[model samples]
Target: MTVYWFMMAWVILFGILAQVSARKVCVGEYLGEEVYESRVHLFVAVVTFAVIVFFAGARSYVADTTAYIKMFNDYPLFQNAHDVIFDSSAREPGFRLFSILIKTYISDNYTVWLSIIAVISGICVMVPLYKYSCNFGVSAFLFMASCQFTWMFNGMRQFLVAAIIFSCTGLILKNKTLLYIIIVCILSTIHKSAFILIPMYFVAQGEPWNKRTLLFIGCIVLAMLFTSKFTNLLTDVVEQTDYATSVEEFRNTDDGTSIIRILVESIPIILAFIYRNRIKGKLTPIVKLSINMSLIASGLYVISKIASSGILLGRLPIYFSMYNLILLPWLLRNIFDKKEKDLVYYIMIICYFFFFYYQMEIAWGGLEYASKILNVKY
Candidate 1:
């Protein structure tokens, strides 16, 4: 717990410094100054990246971290890549191959492998953020505050896949269909959930709060209300995939989606709706995509709430929830009125801070059980 708090403190401190620096650059650009990238901007981004990698790479405390370590230890290094790739196991093939390669060549240091994964995932996440966010600090702060950063310590392959998919946002915005499809195909090999983005690309291009959006949200609501029936109807289809067994297991669990999580996810969507006009012109494609993805995630949360099979479906939202980190910051920066902008910014920061606290201390407890390095004893 102490370690978690300490880490959180650093995240907050560094995030503030980065936000301040980013705000200056934004202001300079607004004033028609030819502001190239600033030292402070580069420094903060590097520091934030390093901090996340350090924690994510070093920690062995999260539940999934242990499973990942055990899987790496148990995997046979000499296994044929083709066989592993085509294996019917529940594990993602790309991750399996990753583990096999590490075991085959790297020292049997699971920590090193974990760290490498963390660095790759972190870079994939941060690069888009640095390039696209209206204010880098707010985006970074929201990244931590929304619990997206902490989630990186767990859900290793899913986050990795999501990060990779997220890196293609520029392509999606630029309407580069062929290249985007190619990238999505590569990333889907890492996690099947990534395939959802193929359709989502089109869905995100639609106007926000329009008839199409309303219809999409309505369908999700209906699905959530009849989750059991929906799951039953989809069971046969689900059984045909690699996730069949896991889906079966989750279907039997009684847990539902977190209400607090639903609320947290909804805040940005609500804000986007309220400030739609202000944000419509700036970062147009990216904002539209973000709003669309966020709505999809919220709809998933609703479905998670009413389904006995909610736990499995719940994982689908993170792919979209991450966009809020970008969307919210952009909204804060683009507010029409200066005083209102500052007010909204501070309010957003405070709300995100509390959300982060709740996530670490309440919703997901025992966050301090992490280690700074590998524990050889297992």
Candidate 2:
């Protein structure tokens, strides 16, 4: 417990330092035009590297970390791409082929594979986020504090796919249809869920309060109210896919979405809606996408509440919810006046700190295994 709190403190301290460093570099710049200097980028890169290394090196701290290790250890070295792609497993071919290729040429060491994944995922997430966010420091901090960083430890494949999709934020924002489609198609080979975002790219770019937005929101609400029935209807179709086996048991489970997660994700959307007029004019394509995604995530949470198989469906929202890391900071910067921005920033820091605390301590078993990376145990 002591170690967990200490780790959290370090994360918060680094976040504060990132914000301060960004401010120093942008001191003379106009409001909302602060560019992240090369030094600031270096700081971000170093922090990201350190965090990824910690996660990659961790010893069974997260539940799926051990499972992934087992999978890598058990994976066979395929002779060719054809063999790997045609393997009898339900796992996506992209990652399957990647695993085979890595094991065939590189070391079969699971830690090495995990480290590689950590690097790719980190770069994919941070690069786009830095490009799109109004404040790099706050966005990075939210990425960690919101538990999205920690989530990568568990859903490695899904998060990797999501990160890749996130990297195309620029293409989507720029409305480069052909480019975005190509990217999403390539990424979908890693995880089929990436296909869902194909239509969402256009949906996200829509006006916030328009008919289309309201119609989608209403549909989401309707789905929530009849989640069990809706899930049952899809069970047959879902069962026919690779995901069918995985989602089979969840078909009848009554598990609901996490209220804490819902609250954390919804806060930015709520703020955006409240300050729509003030910030709407300032909404960049990236910001617009973030807001739309947040709404979709919130709606999914509501659906997750009533669906017997809600937990399975909940995974769909994560691709969007993660963007809150970028959205929250952008909204804060655009909506608040200079006088109130500091107060709001501090409040957000405190709130997100507790959110991280709850995630690591109360929710995820106190990060008890985190110290294992340092060969220390409580």
- Model 1 has an lDDT value of 0.73
lDDT of 2 at 90: 58
C-alpha local distance difference test of each model: 0.73, 0.71
Model 1, span 2-92: residue lDDT tens: 6555556776788778766663343233334443332237668878767778778888767678888888877776555567656875547
Candidate 1 residue 275 Cα shift, in angstroms, is 3.0
Candidate 1 Cα outliers beyond 4 Å, as residue runs:
23-40, 78-85, 89-91, 224-228, 234-242, 281-283, 308-310, 372-378
Error of 2 at 22 (Å): 2.5
Question: Candidate 1, clashing residue pairs?
Answer: 1-368
